[model samples]
Structure formats: C-alpha cells, structure tokens
Target chain A: MEIIKIENLSKSYSSLKRKNNVLALDNVSLSVERGKIFGLLGQNGAGKTTLVKILLGLTHPTEGRFSLFGDSTNNYKNKKRIGYLPENHRFPNFLTAYQVLYYLGLLSELNYDGLKRKIFEALELVGLKGVEKKKVKTFSKGMMQRLGIAQAIIHNPDLIFLDEPTDGIDPIGRKEIRDILVRLKNENKTIFLNSHILSEVELITDNVAILHQGKLIKQGSISDLTAIENEYRITTDSELDTFLSKSDFVNFQLKKLNGFTYVLSGTDEDGLNKFVDLLRLNGITIKELIKQKLSLEEIFISLIKDLDKVK
Target chain B: MRNIFIIILYTLRELFARKLFIAFGIISTLAIGIIWMILANGSVMINQFGNANPGYDEMEKIVLGFEVSAILFLSDLFILIAIFSCANLISSMLEKGTIDVFLSKPISRTQLLVGKYLGGVTFVFINMTYLVVGIFLVVSFYFNLWSFTVLLAIPVITFTFALLNIFLIISGLLTRGSALGMIVTYFYFIVLSPILAARDSISNFISSDILKQFLDFLYYLLPQVHDIVKTVFKQILLQNENVQYELLIYSTIFLIAGLAISFFIFEKKDL
Candidate 1:
C-alpha cells in the first residue's frame, strides 16, 4: 500500500520586502510504499527538506495535494502514526534522554503505562540505554542525534521520516542506525529519509529520488538509476592489452582497464555477444562478465554537473 | 488534550531545569523570611518608631499596612521577574529547532500554542502563589489576623501576567527572539499602559481631541493591566465597595482575543 502520496507539490517562500520569492519545491511528487526505505537525495537547498516538511505538515504546499495513509485532509490523527526527526533537531537541553523520549512519546499519544518500556527499548535500539538519565546539554552531537532517533521511534510509528539521521554519527553508529532502519522496515514500516550521504542511502534504500535546485532530476531503484546500458566489465584469464592491439574490434567500444579486465560497450546485447565470441575464439578464458554500474554519488554528481553546464 | 498537557509538563520541566524557577523560589523564601523577621519584632519596631506601648488596634493596623506594602512590592516584582523569565519560552524552542518536533506531533498547531501559553502562565502562577501565600501565612501567623483578601493577589497578578504573556508569545513568534518580546511587554506594562491609564489627567494639557480619543481607544483596546492591578489593590484594602468587575471581564476578553490572534498567526506559520 502507498503510505504517502504527493502530487505536484510546490512551496515558495517570500518576504514582504523582497520582490523575488524563493521557490523551494517546484512541482515535486513522489510516493512511499509500505515496508520500504525511500531515500531523498539532494544537495543543500535543493528542496529535499522542504518536501519532507510539506509532507509532515510542518509547512504547507503552495500548490498541489498530498495524503498520508490514504487520507488527504489535515487530520492531525495521521501524525500519530508518523514520526519525524528533522535536521538539526534539538530536544530540551535540560531533559534527560529518558525524559525527552517520555514526553515525546506522550505527545504521540502513547499510554503512560507502556511508555517506560518503549523508551528503554528505543534507547537500547539506538545504543543509548546506559545514558538515559544524562541531560541532553551534556551529550555530544552524536549522542544527541541518537536521542533524536530514539524519540522518533519511541512510539513505534508506522511511517518514519528522518532527515540526516546519520548526520553527526560515527561510521559505527551510522551502521547501527542503518540496521535499525532495516529492522523497522522488516516489521513492515515505511521509512522516508532525506540524506546527503549518498553511499549510505545507496546501501540501504530500496529506491531513491534525487532533487536538484527545487526540481526532481532523477528517481528510481538503486539498480535502475545506476545501471549502465549495454556495458560490461569483462575479466579474462588471458591478457587483453596485447590481443586488442592486434584484433579487429570495430563491432564494439573497448577500453583495456588492466592486464585482463576491459570495459566493453556496445549498441545492443548482440554486440556484447559478438565481443564475447571474439574473446572465446582467441582462447581468452572468460572469468567474469558483469554489467557495469555507476555509484550513486557518481550519478548524482554527473547529473548535477550536467544540469549546471546546461545553465 | 493529552498532547497539550504533555507539552505543558514538558515546558514546566524545562523551566525547572533552567534554574530560574529555583531562583524565584529562593527569592520568595528570603522575602518570606524577611517578612517574618519584621512582623516578629512588632514591639521593637514600634519602640524604634517612638510608639512604645501601642494598643492592639494600632498594632494590627500598623502590621496590616506593612503587610499590604510588602505584598504590593512583591507582587510588582513578581510580575516583572515572571515576564522576564517566561519571555523565552517559545522563542528558544524556535531558535533551537525543537518546535519542529512539537509541530510534527499528533496535536494541532492551536493545541501546541495553547499548551505553551498555559505552560508559561502556569510557571508564573506557581511562583506568584508561592510568594504571595508565603507572605500571607507569615503575616497572618504573627498578627493572629487571618486576612483572606491578600491571597486574591495570586490570581489577579497572574491574570495580569497572563494577558501580557500573549504579547510576549506573539512577539516571540514574529521575531524569533526573546529580546523583542521582553522589551515590548515591559514597555507596555511599565510605560505605555500606565501612561494611557492616567490619560485623563494628561488630557487637560493637550488641545487636540483626536490625540486624546486615540489614547482612550488604546486604553480600551489594550489589556487594562494598570487598571486591573489598581482595582485588585482597592479590593485588598477593602476600600472598593463597587468593584470594577468589568476590568477583569475586559481583560479576560482581551486574553481570549489575544489567544485567538496568536493561534491565527501560529496556524499559518510555516514552522
């Protein structure tokens, strides 16, 4: 089931004195499904956070429509099932970790009887079980981020929105949070995350949408977005540098990566098969022939660079 | 309702942790201690004043007069300190981005704002009650005269602060800082409201009727803080036979209208 649906959502910010308004989101639309991790990728000020805020009702869309859990109205009851950890979020500095979670849990309308256990469980999941009594002012940035996450999931929300959840976290903590998100997804919860860490998003997200300057430029599953067409990284037992120097290789584009590995590109699968046949006939035993793929960061940078060049 | 109550508790906890609440508590204790010391030395006080053998009625009047002065002084001080301390209740949340967590909750924007408004009012009320009741208890114990009239200052003073708090909250929302709210609220209470309340005497020197009418309009439009405090004082001294209950009613209406304005601003705010 579609957990969140937004269509033609746009947001513009204007000051009375400023003649030109800032378009934060322009005709953005996307949906998150149940039990999947959907990542929103963007550079700073690319309207990723604006979109999340609009969906969570922290801000209203200037134009278009959105629905949460199939209900489009401004019913606050939908928020009970949703959790959000905003970028740069802060809990009351004087509150202990436990107190912060307890209060936020109560705000989510959790019964007081079970809130204590849930707080503990959330703390443990975020690896903050021991410092539940320490005031937030004394916590490190990473610790505060953990407490933020704990509060986000303390009520066991069905849909969680985390903007830069792994921000300020160490590599180990990031991995732990990624595991927690996966576990939540396993329990059939939807996760909508906005992140600048492309590698982390590439690793855990089932699908991703990239925004550029208030516009969505690319969006799809990781494999689909990164898959290079009609390209293969072929590894062989025999050297290809000397062989390619002598062979007629006009049927495809080939670049020798090293001793026995070459990047082979062609117009179609037939062209790829012809190159494979030529390699077999030459007694070059094929060891690996895998489709080439780009890293998410590479695609993101290229897309952004390409757009910048067009402007 | 549950969410609003939780925010209130959260706000109270925040006030406690900030140590301002404790600071007010300590000040109240000292004030109460001073009152006790003064009332306990009634004979010595009268002797020092050259009235060594005062009758029971004279002593009671003197003590009640002293008590009234102290209560008024403390009440004024309470309103000032309360306004200063509660000014940042909402602005700090916005500055630190903690309001996003609140606005994302299952509560409406109106509920969140009301919770914050009440939380600040409750914080001031608790401190005012502590100080006022402490003074009343000490004075009543010394004189063996139970005057319930002075206890009424708690709600009256708190109500006055509650009305001013709307200005603070609105300013906090608009400016995203406490300084503007603090300055505006203090300016209104200490300068503008008092000047407008005494406009009738000032009007004699002014020739322009339009300016006087504008002043009168302001007096009627604003929360009648000066007038309400004056009426409460008269009632406490038992000098007011015809209590201006209309002042309280007007202030109450201003409070509701101010709250509605706050809700309107907050509901449409992007954050």
Candidate 2:
C-alpha cells in the first residue's frame, strides 16, 4: 500500500526587502510504499528539506496536495501516525533527555505506564539509557542527534521522516544510527531518509529518489537507477601516448600515467576483443586490468553534475 | 482535554528547568522582604506622627501605613514580574526551534498558545502567593489589620493582572520583536495610563474636555494599576471595604480578550 502520496506540490517564501519566492518544491509528485525505506537524496538547496516539511505539515505548500496514510495533510489523525526529526534538531535546552521523550510521549497521547516504558525503550534504543536525567543543554552534538532520534520514535510511529539523521555524527555514531534505522525498517516501518550522505542512504534504503533544483530528476529502486554495466580499465606499461590522438571508441576516455590506461564505459564484447587485439598489435603489454561497477556516490555526483550543466 | 493537560505539564516542567524560574523566586523573596521592612519602619514613623496629635487612633494610623505600603509594593512588584517573566515567552521559544517540535504533534496551535500562556501565569501565581503570605503576616501580626478574605484576594488580583498583561505581551511577541512588543506594552500600562489618569490641568489649555474624557476612557480600558493592589489594601487596612465587582468583571474581560488576541495571532504565525 502507498503510505505517502504527494501530488504537484510547490512552496515559496515572500518578504519585504525582496520578494524572494524560493521554488523549494516545484510541482513534485511521488509516492512511498508501506514497509520500505525510501531515501531522498539531494545536495544543499535541493528541496529535500522543503518536501519533508510539507509532508510533515510544518509548512503548507503553495499548490498541490499531499496525504499520509490516506488522510489529507491537514488531518490530525494522519499527524498522529507520523514522526519527524528535523535537520539540526533542537530540543528545549532545559529539558532532560527523559523529559524530552516523556513530553513527546504525552503529545503522542501515550498513557503513564506506556509512556514510561516507551521512554526507556526509546532511550535504550538510541543508546542513551543511563543519562536520561541529564539536561539536553550539556549534551554533545552526537548525543543531541541521538536524543532527536529517541523523541522521533518514542511513540513507535509507523512512518518516520529522518532529515540528515547522521549529519554531525562521527563514523562510530553514524554506524550506530544506521543500525537503529535498519532495525526500525526491519520491523516493517516506513522510513523516509533524507540526507546528502549518499553512502548512508545506499546502505539501508530499499529505493531512492534524487531531487535537484526543486525537482525530482530521477527515482527508482536502488538497482534500477545505479546498475551500470560492468566496465574494464586496462593500463599498459609503455608510453602509448598515440592512443589519445586516435578516436576508435565512441564512449571511451584514455589517460596516461606511468603508461597508458584506456577506460571503457560500455559492455560490448566485440569492442573489447577488438580493443585488446589492437593494443597487442601495438606491442603494448597490459599491466593491470580491472572490472568494476559505479558506486552510488559516483553515480549520484555524475547525475547531479549533469543536471547542473543542463541548467 | 488530555492534550491540554499534557501541554500544561510539559510547559511547567520546561519552565521549572530553566534559570528564569530561579531568578523569579529570588526576586519575589527580595521584594517581599523589602515590603516587610518598609511596613515595619513606616509603623514607627506613623506612631511618631500620632504622638504630636495625641488623639490619633493607633489602629487607624497603623492600618493607613500598611494599606499605603502594601498597595504601592504589590502593584510595582506585579508589574515588574509580569514584564520581565513574559518578555520573551513566545519569541524565544520560536527562535529555539522547540515550537516546531510541538507544532508537529497532534495538538492544535491554539492549545499550544494557551498552554504557554498558562505556564507563565502559573509562575506568576506561585510568586504572588509568596508575596501575599508575607504581606498578610506583616499587616496582621505587626500592624493588627489583616483579614483572611484580603489575603486570598490579593494574589488572585495580582495574578489576574499578570495573566492579562502577559497574554497581551505574548500576542505582540508572536508578530513582532519581543523587546519592541514588551516596551510598547509596558509604556502603555505603566506610563501612558497614569499620565492620562492625572489629566493635568495644563493639558486643558490645548485640548477639549471631550478629548480629555476620551483619554480617560482609554485609561479605563487598560487594567488599572490601582486594581492590582486594591484587594490587599481594602481588606487589610480599609476595614470592611469590599473589592468592587465591576473591577473583577473588567479584569475578566481583559484576560479573555488578551488570550483571544494571542490565540488569533499564534494561529497565523509561521512557527
């Protein structure tokens, strides 16, 4: 079942000094299925945060409609089911870690015993078990981020929107957060993961959506979009500088290091054979040859760069 | 109703955790101490003044000093506390992004506004209760003019005025800068109303009686300075003089109107 559906959504802001109408989200449409971790990948100023805010009903869209669990954005019932952790999350500084979660539990309408158990469970889940009484003001950056996650999941929400969940976290903390997200996802929770960290998204997200310049440029299952054909790079020992001058391959680029390496992109068997034969005929012995697929980061950067060039 | 209780609890917990509550407590204590000292000293001076008259009633003299001192101290303390406590109530929360977390919940904007307003009012109640008790002891035990009804009504009136003023300031704070909103509110209640009430005859040379009456009307529209202190003064010192029902009605109206405006503004605010 489609848990979230946004149709033709747009958002803009206005002010006196300048009518700065930022097209934060531009007629964007998408839907997420139940029990799938959907990654929203974007660079800075790419409308990812805006779309999340609109879905959470923090900010109203200029046009179009969105619904959560088949209920409209304005519906309170839908809001009750959704949990959101905003970017650079900040809690009331004076509240202790336990107090923050307890407050959220109250807002979520949990009973006293239920709230207490849930708060403990959430704090333990986020690895903040013993310091529940510590004030949020004295917490470090990573601890604050964990507290943000704890509050977001305190009600055991069915759908969670985590914006840059590991933005400021160190590698160890980041791994812990990733583990928590995977655990939640395995429990059949629908998670909307928004971040510029492509690798983190690539690890846990079942599907991915790439947003660029306030528009959804591409979106599909991780395999569908990033599955490029296997390609080989062959580096020769001798200085075959003449290969750069000849344009035998259509989608091939060559570079000379200690020798020469021809990097071919397509998976044409005949073309590979012909190129190998030609290199042998030139008396160039291949030193190293490796076949590899493009990483998600490489694909993401190339796609966004291409989009930038188009604009 | 559950949401209201939750919000109130949340707000109270958050407020108590902050340093401002501690500061308010210390300030209220010092204020009560000051009031105690003045009443003690003023009673001595009043006795001296009565010594010359020879026929002056001792009870009447002591009651007059207690009434004057309690009225002045209560009004000033309540106004100061109201201004300082609520100056950044809404704007500071909005700035710190705590408001966003609350907004994302199932609670309505109006409930959040009311919760915050009542939270500040609760703090005022606690502070005023201490002051009321302190004043009651000094007036009744020292000056021999304390009444139970006056003790109860003094804090109630002060708290009512504080709520009205805090809500009004919060209404403005939601839309504009906190400092600017607070300054505008303080000037209107503290300076403008009193200046208009005095009606200085010199103003008659340049303005008509209609304009003067209009100014008086505006002054009355405000929560009066005297009303805040009258409960303690009337019962403790003025003997059986009761607080006017009309002032209570006016206070209720102001409190309701102030909260209504705050709710309206907060609903539209982009926090």
Candidate 3:
C-alpha cells in the first residue's frame, strides 16, 4: 500500500534581496510504499529538505499536493503517527538526557507511565543508558545524534523520517543504527529517509529515488536502478582469443585482462550460451561468470554529471 | 490543554537546565535576607531606648517610600531579565535544525508559541511572588506596619509584565538576532513606555496642538504602567490619589492584542 503520495509538489521562497522566486522544489512527485525503507538521495540544496518540510507541514507548497497515511498534509492528525530526526539536531542543553526524552515524548502525547520505560529502553537501545542523568550540553556530536534517534523513536510512531541520520556517527554506531532500522522494518514500520550517503542508502533501501536540483531524475527498486544491461564479466583458466585466434570470432569484440579473464557486454542470452558452449568445447574451465552492476555512487555521480553536461 | 501544560513543563526544564531558575531563586533569597538584616538592625537600635532611630509611624512612612521604590526597581530588573532570557524563546526553536523535530509533531504552532511564552511568564511569576511576599513579611514584622500595597502591587506589576511579554514574544518570533531582540524590547520599555507613561506631563510641555494630539494618541495606545505603579503606592500610603480604570483596561487590551498577533504570525511561519 502507498503510505505516502505526493503529486507535483513545488515550493518557492521570495525575499527582498532576490526578487526572483527561488524554486526549492520544482514539480516533484513520488510515492513511498508501506513497510519499506524508501531512500530519497540528493546532494545538499537538492530540495530533499524542502520536500520533507512540505510533507511534515513545516512549510506550505506553492503548488501540487501531498498526503501521509491517507490523510492530506492539511490534516495535522497524520503527524501523530510520524516521527522525524532532522540533521544537526540539538536538544535543550540544560536538560539531562532523560529529561530531554521525557519532555519531547510528552509533546508527542505519550503519557508519563507509558513513556517511562520506553525512555530508558530508547536510551539503552541507542547505547546511552547509564548517562541519562548527564546534561545534553556535555554530549559529544555522535552521542547527540544517538539521543536524536532515541527521541525520534521514543513515541513509537509507524513512520519515521530521518534526514542524514548517520551524519557524525562512527562506523560502529552507523551499523547499530542500521540494525535498529532493520528491526523497525521487521515490525512493519515505514521509514522515509533523506540522505546524501549513497553507500548507506545502497546498503539498506528497498526502493530508491534520486533527486537533483529540486527534480527527481530516477525512482525504482535498488536492483532495477543499478542493474547493468547485457553485460557480464567472466573469469576462465584460458583466454577467449586462444580458442578463436583470428577466425570468425572477429565480431565478438571481447576485452581481455590479466591473461585469464575477459569482459563481454551487449551479448544476448543465446550468444552467452554459445560462448559458454564454445569455452566448454575447448576444455577451458570457467572459474566465474557474473553480471556487472553499477554502484549507486557511480550511478548517482554519472547521472548528475551527465545532466550538467546536457545543460 | 494537556499539550500546553507539557510545553510549559518543557520550558521550565529548559530554564532549570540553563541554571537561570536556580540563579533567580538564590538571588531572591539573598535580597530578602539583606532586607531582614537591615530592618532588624534598625529595630535593635530603637529598642536600646536611647538611640536616634525614628518611631514606628515615621519608620513606616520612610520605609513605604524607600521600600516601595526599591521593590519597583527589583521588579523592573526582573522584567528586563525576562525580556533578555525569553527573547530567544521562539527564534531559537525556529533555528538550529531543532524546529524540525517539533514541527513534525501532532501539535500546532500556537501550542509551541503559547507553551514557550507561558513558560517564561511562569518563571518570572514565581520569582516575583517570592520577592513580593518576602519583602511584605520582613517589613511588617520588623517595622510593625503591614501594608496590603505590596500584595496589590504583584497583580499590577504582573499585568504590566503581560503587556511587555507581547513585545518579548514578538521580538523572539520576528527577529532571529538576539541582540536585535534585546534592542527592540529595551527601546519599548525605556523610551516608548516611559513617554507613554508620562504622556500628560509631556503634553503640557509641548506648545503645538498637533504634537500634543499625537502624544495623547500614543498615551492611550501604549500601556500606562507608570500610572499603575504610582496609584498602587499612593493608595498604600493613604495619599491623595486619582485612580484611572482606563490604564488597566487599555494595558489588558494591548497585552491581548500583542499575543494574538504573535500567535497568528507564528502559526503560518515556515519553520
């Protein structure tokens, strides 16, 4: 089921210094399904934050519409089921970690009795159990980020919006965060994550959307987006040229490397079968043959670079 | 309603965390102790039977004037502190990426605004109550004079503070710069408020009818807190007085209007 639906959403900012309206989000539209980790990948100022703001009702759209959990952004009750952990978040410094959680949870409308254990559990979940009495001001950047996650999940909302969640976190902490996210997913929760960490998104996202310059360039399942077409890298004990020499294999155009392997692209399934059969006929043992796929980072950089060149 | 209380609680926690609440309590206690010591010393001197200390009635009149003005000054100091402390109430929240966590909640902008606002007011009220009650008790017990004037002054000062809070909250929402907020709040309290407070005197000094008309309009528009202070003291000392209901009514309207405008602007704010 579609948990979030946005139709041609746009946001513009106007100021005295710049008379021209700054288009933050330009006619963007997409939908996120329930029980999936949906990643919105974009660079800074790519309108990822702007789109999140509109969805969260922090700002109004100049045009188009969006709905969360079957309710329009205009209906504020939808927010009751949503949680957000914004980038570079800071809690009130004077409050102890426990007090910070208690106060924010109270705003989330969680009663004290209900939030009491949840608060401690969240702290422990985030690896901050023993330091609950310490003031937030004394926390390190990574600890603050963990506390941010704790507050975000403290109310146990069905949908969570995390913007640059792993920023400032160490590798181990990032792994812990990923584990917690997977657990949340297992419980049928939907996560709408906005991040520029392509590798992180590549690791966990079931569905991915790439946004650039306030426009969405691509959206699909991660596998489909990164799938390489008609391309395979094969490793064998004997090179392909040793079998064909200068014969009818001239049209094959195979690229050889390290005297034992070859990369082949633009070959159909039948051609692949014929090539494998030809190798077997020659008594060359095939070590490995695998389809080559682009990494999200590679795809993302090339996409933006290509768009820049096109303009 | 529950949300409002929650916000208020959050505000108190924020203040307490900053240690400002503790500072307020400690300072107020010290001030009360000093007054008690001074008055008790005077009592000791008079009880020695040959000292030059004034009698009970004279001491009462003298204390009425000195203590009243001193309390007024202390109240003014608290108002200034409240303005400085609470000035960033809205702007700070709207800043530092912290606003996102709040805006995504199931609460309205009005709730956040009112919650932070009332939090500052409640903090100030607690300190004010402590100071006012302590002074009342110290003066009555030591000098053998109990004046209800100090008690009556709490509401008047508090209502006057309500009027200033509008400016504080507005500055918090409108100007993201703390220095700018401070400047705007103090400008109103020091120059505009006093000008409006003594509008009648300023009008008499002005020769031009048009200028006098402008002064009159401003006087009626702004809160006449000076009038509140003067009347409260005069009534306490049983002096001849002219009490005007218009000051209280107009100040209340000003407070309500300022708060309403702040809530409206904040509700539509982008972040």
Local distance difference test values of all predictions, in order? 0.87, 0.73, 0.81
Order of candidate numbers by lDDT, starting with the best = 1, 3, 2
Question: Which runs in model 3 stand beyond 4 Å of their true positions?
Answer: A236-239, A242-254, A257-261, A269-287, B41-70, B143-149, B232-242
| Model 2 chain B lowest lDDT segment of ten | B224-233
The superposed Cα distance between candidate 1 and the true structure at residue A4, in angstroms, equals: 1.7
Better of 1 and 3 by TM-score: 1
- The collision pairs in model 2 are none
Clash pairs (backbone) in predicted model 3:
none
What candidate 1 keeps of the native contacts, as a fraction, is 0.82
TM-score of each: 0.93, 0.81, 0.90
- Quote the true-contact fraction of every model: 0.82, 0.48, 0.82
Give the per-residue lDDT of model 3 (tens digit) for B127-236.
78888888888877776677666676576667767677777788777765566777877887877877877777887778999888887787777766666666644564
Q: Name the Cα RMSD for model 2.
A: 5.8
Which of the CAPRI classes, incorrect, acceptable, medium or high, describes model 3?
Answer: medium
Expressed as tens digits, the lDDT of each residue in A7-115 for candidate 3 is: 9998899988997999988899999999999999988999998898889888889999988888874666677788899888878777889988888888888887878
Q: What is the C-alpha lDDT profile of model 2 across B1-271, one tens digit per residue?
A: 7776777676666666666667766776776677667766764656665563333366555555554556455656666666666666666656534666777777787777677666666666766676667666766676565555545545555555564565455645456556766776677666764565465553666468888777667656765545445443455445556646565566567767777777766665554
